[model samples]
Target: MIIRKATHTDIPSLVILMNNFRKFYQQESNTEEVKSFLKERMDKGNSVIFVAILEDKLVGYTQLFPSFSTIKLEKIWILNDLFISEKFRGLGVASQLLTRVLKFSQETHRHQVWLLTGNDNKSAQHLYRKIGFTNTKFKHYVYNF
Candidate 1:
């Protein structure tokens, strides 16, 4: 297995994985929209994505969007998406992807990395805790437009 930063050439695979992730969250899948969204992020250089490969096949990915903490005055990464194909689950793919994200954060001198997953996503929660993430005192609230 190999894990590496995603480049423009990997957009097609990224789109597929992203759609799968959306579907997992019960969102309607729109390939074109997903492609456009990811393309914009890649073009603007506002996000970092890592892909996992096995036997030359793309198996999984995680995406991080850069942000900053006003109080801390430091860079942070919002881990917005993580997905592994059903066939590729249980193979440590998500764990490897997260490890790479943390390594990148440290190397870039980022102050922190954070993520949110579905409340019912027990599997993901387990993996996150196993990898050293913890629940925080703060609650995450969002107002969608």
Candidate 2:
């Protein structure tokens, strides 16, 4: 298994996984929109995406968005998306992707890495805790436009 940063050529595979991820979250899947979104981010260098490849097949991916912590006066990474293909679920692909994220964060001197998951996603929660992420006490608030 190889985990590495994504390039433009990886978009098709990414779109497939991203669509599946959206469906997993009960959201509508739009391949063109997802591909365009990822392309824009990659073109603008606005986010970091790591993909897991096994024998030339893209099986998993995790995306991080750059942000800052005013309180800490430092940069942080918001791990906004993570997904492993259904057939590759039990093979530690997600863990490998996460490990790459953490290593990237540290190498880039970021203050921290954080992510949000559905409250009902016990499996994800378990994987996160196992990977050394702690649950934050703060509540999340969002206002959709």
Candidate 3:
């Protein structure tokens, strides 16, 4: 398996993985929209995406968006998406992807990498904790438009 940053050439394979990820979250599947969104992000260079390839096949990916922390007065990263193909699960692919993200954050001197998972996602929670991420006391809230 190989882990590396995503490039323009990756968008096609990424779209499939992204669609599957959305489906896992109960989101509607829209390949064109996913492609457009990813293209925009790539064109703008506003986000960082990493992909895992195993035997020449894209197996997993994780995306991080840039943000800033007022208290830290420095940049931070929101680890927005992480998905491994169903067949690739339990193979340490997710952990490898996350390790890459943390390495990236360190290399870029970011304050931290933040991520949120559904409360019901116990498996993800377990993996995160096992990888050294601690549960925070802070509450996360969002207001949908």
Candidate 4:
């Protein structure tokens, strides 16, 4: 298994995996649409993505958006997306991707990183805990209009 930050050439596979991730959240998104969105983001330096591969096949990925925290007076990384393909769920793909994210944060000297997952997703919660994200009592209050 190999894990690394994604590049423009990896966009196609990344998009497909992102579409699957959306479907898991009940969103009906197309791969082409995802690809286009990702392409624009890449060109604009809007976000970061890390992909996990096995035997030359893309298996999973995690994406983070660079944001700022006034309180910390530093950059904040919103761990926006994480998806391990169905075929790779039992493997260590998600763990590896998250490790990469944390390492990236440390290397970049970012303020901090955070992610939100549904309360019922016990498996994901377990993974997050196993990865050492504990005691993060941060609450999400979103008002989308």
lDDT of 1 by residue, 9-70 (tens): 99999999999999999999999999999999999999999999997989999999999999
Cα lDDT of candidate 1 equals: 0.95
lDDT against true structure, model 2: 0.95
* Candidate scoring better on TM-score of 3 and 4: 3
Ranking by TM-score: 2, 3, 1, 4
RMSD of 3: 0.8
Candidate RMSDs in Å, in order, are 0.9, 0.8, 0.8, 1.4
- lDDT (Cα, tens digit) per residue for candidate 3, span 1-145: 8999999999999999999999999999999999999999999999999999997999999999999988788899999999999998999999999999999999999978889998999999999999988987889999999
- Model 2 has how many clashing residue pairs? 0
TM per candidate comes to 0.97, 0.97, 0.97, 0.92
Model 2, 1-145: lDDT tens digits are 9999999999999999999999999999899999999999999999999999996899999999999989789999999999999999989999999999999999999979989999999999999999999987889999999
Segments in model 3 whose C-alpha atoms lie over 4 Å from true places: none
- Alpha-carbon lDDT, every model: 0.95, 0.95, 0.95, 0.88
Instruction: Decide which is better by lDDT, 2 or 4.
Output: 2
Error of 2 at 10 (Å): 0.3
TM-score of 1: 0.97
Name the lDDT value of residue 144 in candidate 4: 79
Residues 1-145 of candidate 4: C-alpha lDDT, one tens digit per residue: 8998889999878888999999988889888889889999889988988889997999999999988888779888999999998988888888889889999999988868889887788999999998888756577799979
